[model samples]
Target: MHTSDEIYHRVLWDPRFDPERFVMGIAERGAPPKRVALEDFVPGGEIPWHRVVFFEADGHVVWDRASGVDRVGEVVDGLVGPEPGDVLAVPAGHRTAVAWLPPDPLWAPIQHIRRAHDRQIRRWPPHVNVLFGFVPEGEFPRALPLVSAALAETPPFTARLAGVHWFAHREGTTVWLDPAAAGLEPWARLRESLELRFPLCGGRSHGFTPHLSLGRSPDPHPLVREAEALLAPMTARVTELVLLARRGDEPMRVRHRVHLGTGDVHHAAEPPPPGNPGPPPAV
Candidate 1:
């Protein structure tokens, strides 16, 4: 966890709970604890949760462990969720986005570089963002049908991650990998459609660059060169667009998956594990 100025900075881990499972960012000194959903922190895996052993010193082991839950639910029930009538601060990560999450093998190399250079490494997994901060989570129910209609005629296509590039900003230089711009016309058309539906969320901060972000640094040329050697051209089949949401600065988690062509919506009960590495393996 990043350093906090707050008086109480806590992380929770449990050796007995999924062995590799832990949860953090759940508590702050003065605020109501955020809702703790098993699907948010853990990735989907084979292990069943037998019990929860909570430790105070620290803190992802599965997504959708909901069905296999036993004593674990009992522990989470007491620890999770906001207290009644408590006011909570709106998190910067509150906004939502639509993106393509490439398979782990494809993005793992870029992620390896990001682990050292990217501050958002823990906040989000690797993805090629389509539309970001487009609407609020509450607006998704409405947004879903709009997205479905916009993409109804569009079919899934394959995207290639081909090269390294950068976006200059006053804060730093953001290095990214190109998702082959020539093939992104369909993505552009979909954006135009959604913009018609949600005008306020239409402006592109980086102006329509279809690249998967690596990370940012004040002087990034050296790291950019390093990434160039480690990175290889990769292709990912784009079958679905993932709708991601977060609660009050918590890490973003999958909310829904909108399939291409058919526009069939799937409520994500257990999102697949993120490409980002989790806790160190048990010794």
Candidate 2:
């Protein structure tokens, strides 16, 4: 049996298949009849045209102009109940078409966050970006304090936002840190230590493993190398990730940290009751 998700996709692909109205089409930069494949039938006498298909769903065109060449224009128009400028291509079976639009802008907020951080860095003192290790489920409460204390004592710079993160140990790799169980914190000590010992160790947070970072510095290779050497001998359990944020914007600083604690415990502004609420009063 088709799962609901699969059925939804099918509907999105061809809503008309189920007699339910949907839209699909290809959007192009320039005018319609966007040239696609070319064929020479009689020494280029009006050149044979290739078929195109346009897919439409939810009243919007999702395919690009190149994709429109697949569906015979007439079929797409008919599927959408006809409209002007709906040119049809020969050999309808040869082409497929779909509605196309610009990519979604859901990531706008992230862009804003980046901009805000960039602006703040200009006024703040020097700092370094460091990736802390992950805290397994049910370990955040115990770990967060250790991380917090480290930052508090960390000389020169202070720890800022500690939030969950997703990162890869190597460059060009991607991983996700469960937001429900991740946290970030900014540490000043780490930053100053690196600067004093290895000035060149700045701005090299590109491909650090275990995938959590504090902030960017100039070149971090030497500092990271030294820190690893030192940490190897001791028990280095990362309880938090940190960054430097504006003092007035402390909440924003905390917003980015990943809480690796269990059951969304990191989100609670206040402590919960001794026991769970069994049920609601009768309505």
Candidate 3:
């Protein structure tokens, strides 16, 4: 059964978002719709989560757990009455990511390669993606403590760019620099811990391979050699894990920084509103 947090997550990031024209409510068939405190709403305690939960947009029920069986605009009737509390506040229209951001001079050389072939140079910094397509941006606040707890035991370390490599995609070839095994071991362990709380944030089809992407290239062999010469000798002091986000097609910006060893999280003093362009990374 879906919890109110899950429903709120859908409302914020799902394609059907329409705060101006949408309403969240509960009702039994033939009963009038009513607003209830989401925090106190217990599924299976009073009203079953799936049977009575519903969302309305533009005057019609767009989603109702009791879909085919219930009437067009109402949920299947539930047994108990509603409770109290404010609607959970959530930001909208952004996707989140977790990464290890290499600082300063490291960014310069990476960008040099990126400037020539990487289309995403401006979209993201020189980063080793630990988790991409992470929890929705609106949920970062809720996810922070869990992320901190998962990473508490993983101490910071120097990460070396051991070599350059390439991956062949259907469209083209992409070049990236590999992190040394010492770095990979800790990163892998941290990823394993995070997976317990966020199973969906794991790497793509082939599983995780820690690398800092140089960019996409039509002929990656020449770029790989050049990147190897320029970047393979570099080492980064990885003391913190950064959480970043972006709206559609916009450049990503840092939302928070989770320090390693101590597991302390640094929150943004004033976060940009959903859909607005955010400040550039301070790295």
Candidate 4:
């Protein structure tokens, strides 16, 4: 996710411009992915067209847009999203844009996001997504056992999931729900347990903001208001925890799924088993 500082280099929500239009700015001369320079760009009326690309630590994986597109990457079929610090091709146009979009609900997006989450639930194994901070590949083992123990010690509970809403972030507007409102106690329990065990996962300066992300909205202001009106809060029962491995060429694989209430646990997939040249596996 682009922080406010970084996103400001691209788009903005201005009252002076038309709500339907996103204001795209000119990137510095000769930036990779081409700097956008939309003609007749208006503050709120019509902004520049923009698209973005995400980069993994090692090299380019999949463009957040799609595959049928070239220059961004192999023209794949589906569209993914950009992670923190990933490059973006900030552009928008009058054409029927089909890729890298927001929740396209005409009314309530809460239902849309909930449906998406439910679809994901049905496909991948269910997991209690507790915050452990992000451990680099090198520190995976150092965090695995601690996180595992924390999961073992924790019990299952229901988390309230309000309908999806927009967050006016520096990185455009992100659509997320506040699960902590209902899952606060359990969340704290897990955080404290994990923190006491490891250095914890977050930076020292920033606290934690546990959220279930739906997606980032290109245009946030109207959607935020519409979401506030149409989105309905719901609940998700916390029972199991799963470690998901994302691959560029395949469906996200489930490394493991552990039932929270029961002591029973099983490893669905083995590590880079024998000859893997990497740190220990982790969620």
Candidate 5:
């Protein structure tokens, strides 16, 4: 499946398909498409984990599930999906998409528990973004203004969120369904038009993996595993976007929120530091 033009994705199910087989061209300014073929030192069981880590590819439209992933827990936490992934190809685009507010039943507990697990979770930040494309570096500071204009000019789009599932990744890195797959398309189309002008301007490139993120590795596995049944399906019209600022492993600081259809920017009462402090060291 192609998430965007020039970007391709394939789910590698065959155990024997070594990553070293194909040559790919990556995205680089004025650089010729490098004839790069890679090798894999992975076994099938670890592919789920490996797929989210050990790869550092970008600028190429080839969405190799077997391509560029880095092994750091924080990087992998953001890169991997909520579900255990057999998927490859980190998405290349902007994360400036719409937002979904899950029902209280699902949202409340996840936030509480994930907060307690804050010191341990690598990338479950309780937030999601509909990335459009990677933007040129110099143009990023205008993110808020651009989003504001689009929201005011564009009408609110429809989207649905209706599933709850538990997926385990790596050493107990578990996540629940924010199910961006269920709701992002309509918003994705909307974000696409503006994205042509702006790519990953809002945040890091997380590929196509989209989920609300319940918690992470050091969380209680059996508890999270069983609580899967407690979740109920939810669908709501996404009407806004929450701009976030984080400080390592402390907590997510809400910077601003932009209402859809109005493009109104709701700045935080106390804004966070200018930028994120990034992921903390693994405990």
Candidate 6:
């Protein structure tokens, strides 16, 4: 039978990007040898299942013990390889195994992740629009969630399934700001509609709430009165709604919905402009 140490050595020495060159030995004594593409054994439909090795890129293994039984049998031939307890290096992305099996083991982890993703989609609320908002310095404590709740009635047009999100501002808040620009026009209209509908207090500041970010603020009541008093007379327009996502340590704007509101009406006391560029780089 092949020793676990031997298998480990082979993986360490031959790791490479060329999926075809890599080879896995069944055992020391059993079956005729065989070779195949590494991708065939991946478990998941798109992402696939592979063991991640120590190498930066070349470390990955894909094998399905159940469906690939015939393939594995061909690779091992009839050799009485390592017993169930003997360890073997499958591939880099594959999960750790106590030992190598004569035939590969069925890939189960991929199925689990798929099921979880489906469940998350099913549980999501249909009406919620997931958006992120940054709390301007003075705006943090009171404005975040309150604004989010106020706009709960607005429906998400893009990802109708994912609920709106108002992530805390900081370094991470930039992700949502970029896409916000797209909804500026529609947001401006919405703001105008709101101003026309609600009694505006004098001297209060007013701003358009992008459909996605309507519910992002924590509690904006304190500022609401002041903002309303300042903004009642002036019109509010939103040119875009920024959709941001974390990329590495910084936030990146991943998506944008422009011209959300009807016509344009610039608001007074609009917060300083935010920084960041187009939809966050694709994953």
- Candidate 3, residues 66-177, lDDT tens digits: the string is 5532232222232111111111222232267787877765666777888788777667767787877687877787778767876787888888877888899998898988
Query: What C-alpha lDDT does candidate 3 achieve relative to the native structure?
Result: 0.64
Each candidate's clash count: 8, 76, 1, 19, 27, 85
TM-score, cand. 4: 0.44
lDDT: worst 10-residue window of model 2: 94-103
Q: Model 4, 19-79: lDDT tens per residue?
A: 1222222433467453232223433343332433332212333222333212212222332
Ranking by lDDT: 3, 1, 5, 4, 2, 6
lDDT (Cα atoms) of all candidates against the true structure: 0.58, 0.27, 0.64, 0.41, 0.43, 0.25
Q: Report the candidate with higher lDDT, 1 versus 6.
A: 1
lDDT (C-alpha) at residue 156 in model 6? 32
Which ten contiguous residues of candidate 4 have the minimum total lDDT?
Answer: 94-103
**Lowest lDDT 10-mer window, candidate 5?**
4-13
Off by over 4 Å in 2: 1-210, 214-217, 233-248, 251-267, 270-283
TM-score for all models, in order of appearance: 0.62, 0.20, 0.63, 0.44, 0.46, 0.18
**Candidate order by decreasing TM-score:** 3, 1, 5, 4, 2, 6
| Native-to-model Cα distance after best TM-score fit, residue 179 in candidate 1, in Å | 1.3
Measured by lDDT, the strongest candidate is 3
Best candidate, TM-score: 3
- Where model 6 places Cα greater than 4 Å from the true spot, the runs are 1-221, 233-242, 252-283
List, residue by residue over 1-283, the lDDT tens digit for candidate 5. 2221112122122222323332343333476433433433232332232233122333323343434432211223123311212222333333223334443344555555556444433433445555533332233344566656656655665544445445556676555555554656655554543343333233434444456655555555654654455545555556776554444543433456777778788765343223333344244
TM match of model 5 to true structure:
0.46
Q: Report the C-alpha lDDT of model 6 over 1-283, residue by residue, as the tens digit.
A: 2232323332232222233434442322255423323334233334212331111112222223333321211223222222231122222211110110010111122122223222222211101122222222232223222322223323332211121223455432211111233344433433332222121211114333332122223444432333233222212232233222222433232222222233121223221123311122223
